[model samples]
Target: MTTELRNQEITIQPEDSEVVLSVERISKKFCRNLRRSLLYGVQDIATELSGGKRTSAKLRSQEFWALKDVSFQLRRGEAVGLVGSNGAGKSTLLRIISGLINPDTGSVKIRGRLAPLIALGAGFNPILTGRENIYANMSILGLSTKEIKAKFEEVVDFAEIWEAIDAPVQNYSSGMAARLGFACAVHTEPDIFLIDEVLSVGDVKFKMKCHRRLAKLRENGTAFVLVSHNSHSILNICNTAIYLAKGQLITVGETEAVVRKYEEDLCLSGMEKATGPLILPKKSPDESFGLDITLVCFKDAQGNILETPMSGEPANLCVECFAHKYIDNANLGVVVKSLSGENDRVLYFTSASDNEFLKISPGNTELQIQMPYCCLIPGAYTAKIYIKSGVCSFDVVESFRFTVQADKTISRCLFYQPRTWKVISK
Candidate 1:
């Protein structure tokens, strides 16, 4: 692979296929202990210099494979999203392709110029101003001096950090540094672009800008290998997805299919780690003079308590609350949470949020809210009962458990309507 990425000597070879970047069974490993890591590095160097190859056939003590036998090919005008939980080697793979790191086995063949956005501003000189660093960074990415100067204003402008351009990079905030780094990488416009969660940092607007710019790059036949925890970003930007788990490829196919498979694994794993019922605890107990939640449950149309509610079907949410005093409208709601635990992931059935005024009089009461469509991806979930007026009138962490049984429709989308999380990772 004869590519022109800075500090990389991968020469492009004629391919029978028109792939832009080909990652063939790439694998990488890291030692947990820093001392062992340094020692092993020296030993490997010495062994190789002695005309002996470094052994990497199996795991060394205190070492683990961050990536193992992963392979993929990116064609021009296509984007592939890398989706996985943390420690899944997404970043490691990007570093390997970018030539920041090398794989233990297999080969990476590139057919054109490439840009790797591993850690934003990683190559920046801290003492230099942002403006100066841009020149240095882009130059290292294969830009000529004249080209850098020509695109100087555009880079700063796109980064939205014109005011900070002359400031020392070390003084810039994390967001600022990330913005400048992303802008520089994108402007390079290489045939293949590798991004590793750098987009997860910036604010929403800047992220939106990044997405739009990435779309433009795609239009120009740039292929992307994007590592993102955000399923929505992946679905929006990539034509396909590769799911990695514990350094192994789980699935690689159409974006939705791959994302759903990843989500299913997350749900199953969260459930395995969860204690019984997965109910969220109420932060505080209900006031004696306020409302009290008696029960919260989901039932099918037949009025039978739903043992396992399937996705994409109608179910009724019943919230039974007892009010101590008369109130014109007491906000009643249920919070849907994954079995994984506290993350404040909630779906509002509140009378206040939905403008359904509930007249609560002192006594036992029950309100059944109709969920015409349950968009929750198949998973074990717990719901919290909440009744609020001025303060949290009544909220209980205690509850029964419900499982949304997986179905073919679980592949609905990254953004299931109402308030939904694609997948909650522990």
Candidate 2:
């Protein structure tokens, strides 16, 4: 990689200028059942009605740790990515930082006014018109009437909702509401910002505007804690990244390194789960069509099963498919699923031109497929590999299963080519 390509310089401001946000050993626990407490209440009432005072009744419940001993600090002008699998405490951490939820332990120290975009339409009145909702949201975001009035046009323009500015928010689509909420949040002149994947909404143009606004704020020493599964966004913008799992921060480092680690952890966990001997599904002999997979692995540059690789290195995927018949013209493909099961991002598909089509003459054939590194982000992603010969195209398939990790050290940025930035100071 050229110096210009590999070395994407980020301006590092002084770290001692009063840490904008300090999250120290914070943890959050939740009770699973409210009905248990209700039952205890009824039991206590029955005991008291018998003319005998009862001691405190135990509340049957199940405990869940959403966060545990997670610590990090954000100096002014710093941006950090909070990433994790679903139920990995990414949202919980954001909620705690936004003060929407209190932590069970430790503390969050935040300085200056904060703008949180954790939830779309969190403060908006659904029944109110878009104009009224904007006003209400701005007020809740600490904007004065005069300030809202002054920036009203800019907000509408940024949100690209000039035509629907007067419509009720309830009538707006989810994207429209998200755009409005994002507009209101950015309008507030805040020293700290907490965002949770709100940029995934709206169109590309709106997303660009949001990125520009974030860049402007970041240049002004406004710290940000962004919770997102989109590694590209985090890598392109954030100075640091933290990966959380099971309510604990598993990794933290420079944006590039941290993203790579997060992807690695995801792959490792999935592999362990898939490789455990007891994961085999029970089979009933009555079922005629039964298929199983074994020895799923990714290949390095030299066509070897690769467990890990430095960023920017070459890699490929190798999986052996076992079929029970002479399947011809099978469409071999792989679908990469996120850990959260939100959506499966297609990694690769080959019908006959993958140059990898194999004809099984009533026997099992080892099929190896290769994919370049540019197609994936540096994160843990699961894969579903299959061979389909009929219109069904799913004769031998694994949906919502399998896992593969991308190697990113080969690139300067996280997954894609690094973008250029020009710094201008008056």
Candidate 3:
């Protein structure tokens, strides 16, 4: 593109001397049909050759904006994670930033050298050996023959694919190529690193090594714009995050808050009526079980509905179950699950454990379990209820999710334990 488009030049704040990358009001569109895309490509080429500018502001038929009005700036020593659902244009934004593709409108300004692991194995020729491909990529990165030779052993060691170092790249699996690409990029120590989800390809050990390397680079003030579905990785490596939805910027802030919001949005999106206040509709009962879980919610001691409760604060678990026929005795159990992890079972309690049993009637029965205070840490959780008789499950309710806001007296933690300390030892 033209120098006028350099680094988006939107604000012209060179005196700041910190901002390393800037994307200004950028947008890009793609055509659905391959033939139409190629035709449009040729037409644009012709127009450019004839000194005519194609209007990028408007879209042709079968075209949709892959990214729209996206803008952000990355400073030295900042690692920003991009979290979004599939087809959210995260990869498209990375490509544009890496100069693999250009935006239809606006421009991107990158102040220093960039190393992109956006498309692993993209530059390797089928017939070329991995060794040869590594040399070629380093050469293209402005490393001389001597520098490339010096770093060859280091790259292979980091990639952990030395056994196939001399094998043709065509014989390499996607994971192998990705590991090699990641190894090469990090070893070069570019000023800015554009990482997509290629880190997800390798084994856990290799991924750990990658994270360690990224940590070192971050410590040395190398900026990163990483796109990944793995929030755990993002939380571990990034201090900030950006959330995107339908090619639009949703929120940009501290990594924990942004990731949490994105995840809750995903959970909320799957339910009916994504817009209105969070009230779940009654679901049908299992005909075989002859019971229905009509409503499950949380409330305070005052009986006011609490969408989110405070951590380590008093809360009430309320459930309304409709029993089809009268039953002699039913055992009620509730399972509290932590959503931030892989649906981990945090707590489970049952009325049977307390030597109590419910006599089911042929109508809705309200059950309320009051807790002195929730001891769980601040995070998302779900409560699941099940009604059983002897050993047979009669009713099973889906999880109802809610967040526990951090108590003013406490902070985010793994687990909460009330304790007191003394200065006796000191």
TM-score of each: 0.79, 0.73, 0.80
Q: What do the candidate models score in CA lDDT, each in turn?
A: 0.77, 0.69, 0.79
- Once fitted onto the true fold, the runs of candidate 3 whose alpha carbons sit more than 4 angstroms away are 1-15, 119-127, 170-175, 270-288, 301-303, 325-363, 367-385, 389-391, 399-401, 407-426
**Pairs in clash, predicted candidate 3:** 7-108, 7-109
Candidate 2 lDDT score at position 230 = 70
Candidate 1: residue 390 lDDT (0-100): 58
Q: What's the ranking of the predictions by TM-score, best on top?
A: 3, 1, 2
- Model 3 — TM-score against the truth? 0.80
The sequence of per-residue lDDT tens digits that candidate 2 reaches over residues 81-183 is 9888789999888887776766656777666778998887778888889899888889888788999999999888877788988888888898888888898
Please give the range of 10 consecutive residues that has the lowest summed lDDT in model 2.
Answer: 1-10
lDDT of 1: 0.77
199-312, model 1: which lDDT tens digit per residue? 878899998999899888889999988887766567767899999999999889998778766765665574553222232322223435466665566778887777566677
Per-residue lDDT value at 28 in model 3: 91
**In angstroms, how far off is 169's CA in candidate 2?**
2.8
